[model samples]
Target: MRRAAWGFLTPFLALFALFFVLPLGYALVRSLYAVRRPGLGFGPASVEFAALRNYAAVLADPVFRSALGRIAVLGLVQIPVMLGLAAVLALLLDAGLARAVRWFRLGFFLPYGVPGVIAVLLWANLYVPQVFPLAWTDLLAPPYVLAAIGNIVTWEYVGYNTLILVTALQAVPRSLIEAAAADGAGPWRTAWSVKLPLLRPALVLTATFSIIGTLQLFSEPAVLRTITPAVSAGYTPNLHVYNTIFTDDLPHLGAAQAVLLAAVTFALSIAFLRVTRRWSAA
Candidate 1:
């Protein structure tokens, strides 16, 4: 039976190894090397093992540090706000608000169906003073661009998260809800005492996704970069890596930064899962 199971999984395992493991291994190997040019850039460039020099340089970079700080703040503010909105919407839908659950769900989820680049472009117009008469130009400024990007992310994913929560709510045993009602729990009390707790796993899932998405934020800012000076080539870590590869002509350095970012993201995800596990256990 175990051999049969392995046979059944072989194709997927092979594909995973080919697509995910192989590329990751290649990137890791590339990140340890630096391209060295001869004096006056006259000879063939050679790849030299850089050890941790590339990583050290990336960490010491002020732009990269600022990008990290910016995303951290964005995640802190955006994740809660997005999840809160999603939870409320899910609760309302589950409660059969106005008896139009299907329509409401579709309406809420419509933004997520829109292509991310198009959504960013649409929002960029609203932020760019030259394009819209009522534009909030201040929000497009350097100091507030992070928040603006957060708002865009929240808008895009809130509905998707709402759907996840709603599905979780749907899976709650009907008898538990009936018992709550029999014990004199009103809608609000039932939702507070029963439904919310049941939805914890869904909440954690959405939060984890939001954390990963926030760290990997790229498209929205990339789209906005052309329209506003607020977003520079190195506005985000992903953007920094992109600029290093394309604009600065340092693919090895860019690969190192990309690897470092992935490492940080992995560490954060592990920490979050550990905390959530403890919380759930308690």
Candidate 2:
């Protein structure tokens, strides 16, 4: 029976090892080397081991630092706004506020179902200052660009997060809500004191996913860049890597940046898990 089960799993394991692990290993190896073209006549110059040089170079670069800072600011503003809206929407949906709760739920999540590029294109049209005369003058300003991109992310993701929160809220027993109401607790009080605590796991999960997504944010910004000049080639870490690998023709440096980005993401994920675990235990 064990051997039979192993046989069933073998193909999946083999494919995963070949595609995922091998590519990751290759990227790591590539990150350690620089392709050096010594002779000029299209001859092979060979790969030189860079050790920590590429990492140091990437770390020392101001653009990389700025990109990271931009992403940090975007995440700080985006996640809270998105998740807060999601929580409120979830609460409203769960509180049986409207007869069309199912429609509203589907409507909200529908944006996420849209293709990202198409969504950006649609938003890009409305983002025009002329669309809203009051906001016309400030539409394409530098300060508004980050928020524009953030709004795109929020609009795309809030409903999905809401679904997660709502699902978690659904798991809370009706008896608990009834008991709280019997004790003279208001709806808001019940949500704050009773529901939010139990939904903590879902909240943490959504936050973590949002954090990871924010770190690697690219498509919306890339699409928006065509409309807004404020988003440079290296506006975010992932953008930086994309530019380095494809635009600048420096795949090795891009690989190094990718490795560093992964490390940073892993560290932040670990920190998030630790903090949430402590909060849950307490």
Q: Which stretches of model 2 miss by more than 4 angstroms?
A: 1-20, 39-44
User: What's the distance in Å from true for residue 4, model 1?
Assistant: 5.2
For model 1, how does the per-residue alpha-carbon lDDT over 77-136 read when each residue is reduced to its tens digit?
Answer: 999999999999999899876477888899889999999999998887677778787765
lDDT for model 1 comes to 0.89
After TM-score superposition, the amount by which residue 145's alpha carbon in candidate 1 deviates from its true location, in angstroms, is 1.5
The true-versus-predicted C-alpha distance at residue 80 of model 1, in Å, is 0.9
Instruction: Superpose all Cα atoms of candidate 2 onto the true structure and report the RMSD in Å to 1 decimal.
Output: 2.7
Q: How does candidate 2 score on lDDT?
A: 0.89
lDDT of each: 0.89, 0.89
Question: Which pairs of residues clash in candidate 2, taking residues 3 or more apart in a chain or in different chains?
Answer: none
Model 1: residue 52 alpha-carbon error in angstroms: 2.0
